[model samples]
Target: MASQPLDPGNSGRNDPALLRLPSTVRHRIYLFLGVARWDGCPLLFDLDGPVSPSDQVTFYGLLLSCRAVYTEVSALLFSSNRFVIHYRNKRSLQPLRNLTPPSLAALTSLKVVLNQASCHHRREAEASGACCTRVSGCFTRKPKGAGGHCLIRRPHKNLHDTPLQSSDPSARLMLEEWRATAVYLSSNTKLDALELSLVCDVDQKEVEAAEHVVAPLLLFPKLKDCHVRLCISPNSHLRQLARNASRQASSNPALEPASPTSGSSRLLITLPREVRIRILEYTDLVAPLKEVMWNRLGLGYHYFSSGCSAWEGVPCLPPYHHGCQYRDCHGQGIIKDGIVRSDQLRSIGCFCGVRHAAFSSTCKCWAPPTPLFLICWDLCEDARFVFFSANRFVVSDSLVSANPWLAYDVSFTPDPKWLLENRSNYSWMEWYRQAQPPRAYPAHRFAATKFLREVVPADYLGYLRFLELVFPPYNHECWPHDGHPALQDWIDTVDWVKDKINAPAITLRLVMAGSRMWHPACPDDRGGLTRVQGIAVLTGYNRILKPLAVLREHGLTRFYADFAWPWKWTNRVYERLRAADDPNTILSWLEGQETLLNDRAERLILGEDQHDRLRSNEAKPGPSPWKMHSGREY
Candidate 1:
């Protein structure tokens, strides 16, 4: 046979032009070519195969280019991507054991899958009918009497046969390997996130054994997010182990007293109290505390804007649109698309809009100073004081409406539909009942109210200087109505605040929107307020303010009600009312506006001529001034 020609793949290794580039430049080139992109999925590794099934074909050519090329890019391949290894047997972890020290040190994220096969050696030993004598609930293979056979014991009842101290030689070896692997990972790897998933058919005893096997890995000090999943039960001993590890790691340095004669701790202690506090402030310890409904990883704030508007003639577009509140506004879309179509103006209607912006917690501009609180007891106290006293905590209507048990309970597995809705990444209005179903609010059990009551420490409540409670826009049919559960929940929350927070300046804000009218074709596409619907707005406004009376009680005079209606002229009216120090001014202004709104409603209902005249004027408009410069779009 003729000798095989040299492989083109191998030939690339000697390419002089590519090899001449600097290592940094070559690394970027490899990354640009998609060598490091895993698209949020973990990179799978299996000891049985040279590479994972998903990547073997794709990376084969590049990796086989030459040993030199592999040496340069292997670090990037291992470090930049998250690696997951599945443990099936004693040798299942060979892939991890094979990684070089440098490659192991560069790892940022890792996940390990432990399954029933991990205990195969123990199962096999039991199947072979090995004889043993029980001593203190543990089975040993040595005979009790000379020349006498030991009695066989059932493996299921042998709870002491944990992987770590198993009678079976293979089982003990496997545990040793696991311990060694855990030691290597904890000492060498720089993991930010680690997950240990035990998806095995296991009883309580087996579960405990599995926990022992993974305990060391759970104690990795540098992890920011550590998750342990036990398929047999909702709770896991390993989960508690992970928590203890996290707590110990965070407090270890501070637990031991620093030498008074030397080190930075002494220098820190020497500084004046004011100077230390000033330095802490610069560390962003005073970030706002806000509530989030989904993927809430740590303490941080999210920003969102909401508004309502009324449109004349045929409504311009959908009632709800998600984008920049001003630039891509649905109301503006009507004007941009030309309000006058086929010599007719769109009918008048109401629009309610809300848009979610970026969350500050995930932004890389600054790291959370929560770790600073764990540095020392004195620092922790100072951090908490600055965090609660200097920043505003906002409790929104959506937070109150959410089912806290479902959202906050790690053990509770929500319905598939609920999970899909939250994970879909759709732009949704948190306050809208149509988008987010409201939980039946119980006075003492409401999620938001309960969080304020029980979750926040009592001492921190005293430190609070500013608190903002935001209620959804008033709906005549629902809000402040007799026996409304949500209304009761709100009242109970205010009562709790009054009782607990004595000195904090409270801001009560009501979001207002024009009444919505559904389009003839699409039920979900709603229009802005009509003349008749405007009456409901006035009635709703009057009813909503009745709840604010609870805030006017003794020691609660620091509170003020803000009616945040987004309409230009309406906003100015509310702004002027807000400028007054007395609550009586707001009530008086609402009374006057209610009377004027009622009069307009009556004329529009009874007089056809006024409706025609209003429509005629709307038909003459080029761009509705209200839509152009709404008080604050979003």
Candidate 2:
């Protein structure tokens, strides 16, 4: 075989002088000769044998040109490019098995594309020693017999004449063959990534079953990366049937057809730009100062919540209408046990009757919507710019000690019950401790903040219109013990934010939580100052609001008095003040004002009758009733 003359094109390439060139030149020439396709391009090794050598020549032509060239380039050919194997039957393994050790050693990544329809037919041919007679076009109409009878076409020889199994076999045999081949390949090569794709007809049920069997085999521990994709043929009968059903249904006037734009439209690129924006606006993408996650893994539903305990009891609310005002909650207040607590504060009323037991329990805590970025690059680009520009990203006070971006690095909190013995100690103080403290400790917040400022790309923040700094609620322990330290850290963070903002004109939201009213004072509480002590509440407000007023003086505009006990009253009294207004004005006015704290303290000092008389005199009217049938007021 070595002495014989090679094929026409193979003859001229057999020059011994080629080896005399510099190694670099030789490697470059070899690269051109060996690479069937560009790097990363799929070099498909069709399992169905080519009818002619010409098809094989397209991929392996240069290798057969000369011995020296083949020796030099084969390794580069295998290693530099990705190899794809199109599998149909047992015969698909032939090329992989035939690979020389050197070629196998050069291999780094392999992708296998399996066609279930072909595999099914191949299996049928193997079992019956022929193609299924029942299938249309399996036999030709041409007659070759003496009596002019039609003749049946013989099955391909590669299948080997064997009886097909009557039942659809679990992918065991197929998987076993693949496993053996995978083990052999692993032994021979330094494989980096293994990808397996299943292409099947539109029987979703059967495709899933086939995928379940074939997918796990791709996950060889030795492979550094693994991916499995399922592609259903457009010609799938099930899809055609579904389309037909939809057409038939649309023809019937009584059957109301759902609007095409009712849900998230997958063909966003195809839609007009305005339509896309309209659709995206409804998503959290455009929500202001709210945490939005795209492609989240938990809940599998659509909802939002202000971070609160999932297990907290529902608040008692008065009559409400879809478009009712915030003060629509009847003059009633938050009723705990049977006792009506202090008159319903607007801050508490904001969350009154709001429940998220279904979503919060399942959601991962503070997880970023990373999957949003995983879609097509164009869509990701469009969405990110729009999202960052439209909404103000908030780094709560706890997160301000460090960069906010770092928060995305933390995973969602798992169910405490799932932790078994590792769960937090739920003791006497646990309720009080958990209630006032930040859900995520400072360290996690710091990491998240760091990630936001440093890790998130500058372009994403280029159009940032707003940034919110939420002052975490202070419990009694947080206030007296750690208040100064927390306040100092927050002030430093505000300074950093002022200097770092990228936008020309950005609004800052300074959110103050109603820490005084966060925990209702318990009667069983002993000699320690009440959770809402007069001096402690006064000092905490002075500590928080003083710095906040400074930031406002420096031009931070949106002061969100979040969860303030008298949300309505507090907003009316304090939020309405000018940007440069003095913090002490409100502080001095509040000092003498009758509030829940003063009422509770006064009740203790005086008797119940005195407080009751005061409460009755100041009682607000209940929500207005619905109009009567005659259109007259009740």
> Number of the top candidate by lDDT?
1
Model 1 bad stretches (over 4 Å): 1-56, 59-82, 88-91, 97-177, 180-285, 288-388, 399-463, 473-476, 485-544, 550-634
Question: Which 10-residue window of candidate 2 scores lowest in summed lDDT?
Answer: 353-362
Which sections of candidate 2 miss by over 4 Å? 1-279, 284-371, 376-378, 391-468, 480-489, 499-507, 515-555, 562-634
lDDT of 2 by residue, 343-462 (tens): 222111111111110010111222233445556676577667666666545543332112111111212343467445545653433433333333222332232234245544655655
RMSD per model, one decimal: 19.3, 29.5
- Could you tally the backbone clashes for each prediction? 10, 18
lDDT of model 1 at position 395 = 47
Per-model C-alpha lDDT, please?
A: 0.41, 0.38
> Pairing residues by index, what is the TM-score of model 2?
0.30
For model 1, how does the per-residue alpha-carbon lDDT over 97-198 read when each residue is reduced to its tens digit?
A: 787777676665555544331111122223221113321112212333323333343333322222222344655556666677777767765654333322
* Candidate 1 positional error at 572, Å: 22
Clashing pairs in 1: 313-346, 313-347, 313-348, 314-346, 314-347, 349-528, 349-529, 350-527, 350-528, 350-529
lDDT of 1 at 9: 48
Deviation in Å, model 1, residue 365 alpha carbon: 12
Worst 10 residues of 1 by lDDT: 347-356
